[model samples]
Target: MKRISLCLLLTSFVITPFVQASNTESASLDHAQVTYVQATQSQNGSWCFNTQVHHNDQGWKHYADAWQVLDLQGNVLGERKLLHPHDNEQPFTRSLCNVQIKPDLQKVVIRAKCNDHGWGDKTVTVNLLSETGKGFKVTRNNK
Candidate 1:
């Protein structure tokens, strides 16, 4: 009985650190971030955005749930819903197409949303006239 108790204690000591570390890591990554954004204008005049997000997805209970395109005035232009948690995929890319934007708009913002956290603070601003900026790229298919 004493030997079994000692082995159990040793196992707990080893396991405790791992569990604690995992909790800490998850806490730090609870918020999602928009890592990259690619915007393109189609020949039909609609817009498409490819967004990349990073989050520590624990499971269905906690994950990066969606991303959205917003104008400078914070009006939601379009949204892409993520159906499931990408636990194995650290940074995943998703596309939202057929988004109609105002012709006079110069810039737009892309933000990430998580199930646990409503919305993250980190956002990517996409300039319609510029080809590239910080974490975003813009392209136009005139043909």
Candidate 2:
């Protein structure tokens, strides 16, 4: 009886491992300043684009009218309007644009200018947001 009980106990313990569910790791990143996250891949699969911009400034009129888009190669793809009306006092602004994340891409850059004549321009760099890679942990990823 002792031998039979010992075998049963061991079998029960061994079976538990296979019964437990396995967790799958998500290919994603999360953060407070991650107001936006995109894992979009282009049809050609040449690059992966992930972008995040925040309006975290205070006491300032926006000084710039355009939002420049740059690829991992630092080439200017295009530029668009800041989207918000001229505001000099919007205590904060966040995520000026969404990113088209292509596959196999490595880096992306963007630029934003505050309306305040006294304030300098903002250049944001988002790196390694590609598949199988880690993204930025944003706190003030504001531009």
Candidate 3:
């Protein structure tokens, strides 16, 4: 019983992330060269960034989502989100998109919003997988 319980815990933390990563877009912050990245902490203990979305699928109906935060060395300071990622501003999503982050985080939340034609501003949250990035490319494509 002990072994079975341990296995379940490990599997939830280890194996589940891989499956989720496939559904959520992701990128590598580590690259041969440092890329466009920025990270700042909010007074409320959240992370804010202005970066490109990776694997951005193209098309009018096709929507893409990615949020990236790379350090000076192209390492992700924390988790990344991939599209119209956040909005601390008033004109934009109006605080609809935000992030809760911590140092050496055990987990992170990903949020996204969009104005597709008439429908938009959808928000969702997912736990951070055991993976992180350092640097990445800003090309537009869906994976």
Considering every candidate listed, which one attains the maximal lDDT?
Answer: 1
Candidate rank order under lDDT: 1, 2, 3
Error at 112, model 2, angstroms: 1.3
Clash count in backbone of candidate 2: 17
* Residue 28, model 1: Cα distance from true site in angstroms: 4.4
Evaluated against the true structure, the overall lDDT of model 1 is: 0.91
Clash tally, candidates in order: 0, 17, 13
- How does candidate 3 fare on TM-score? 0.27
How would you encode candidate 2's per-residue C-alpha lDDT over 40-143 as one tens digit per residue?
43344333334443443332243333455578576775445544533353322333334444445556655544344321234455554433334333222212
Please list the residue runs of candidate 1 whose C-alpha ends up more than 4 Å from where it truly belongs after superposition.
1-28
Candidate 1 TM-score, true structure as reference: 0.79
Per-residue lDDT of candidate 1, residues 39-105 (tens digit): 9999898899999999889899999999999999999999999999999998999999999998789
Residue pairs with colliding backbones in model 1 are none
Residue 7 miss distance in model 1 (angstroms) = 56
TM-score (C-alpha) between model 2 and the true structure: 0.36
Q: In model 1, what is the error at residue 109, expressed in angstroms?
A: 0.2
Candidate 1, residue 140: how far the Cα is off, in Å: 1.3
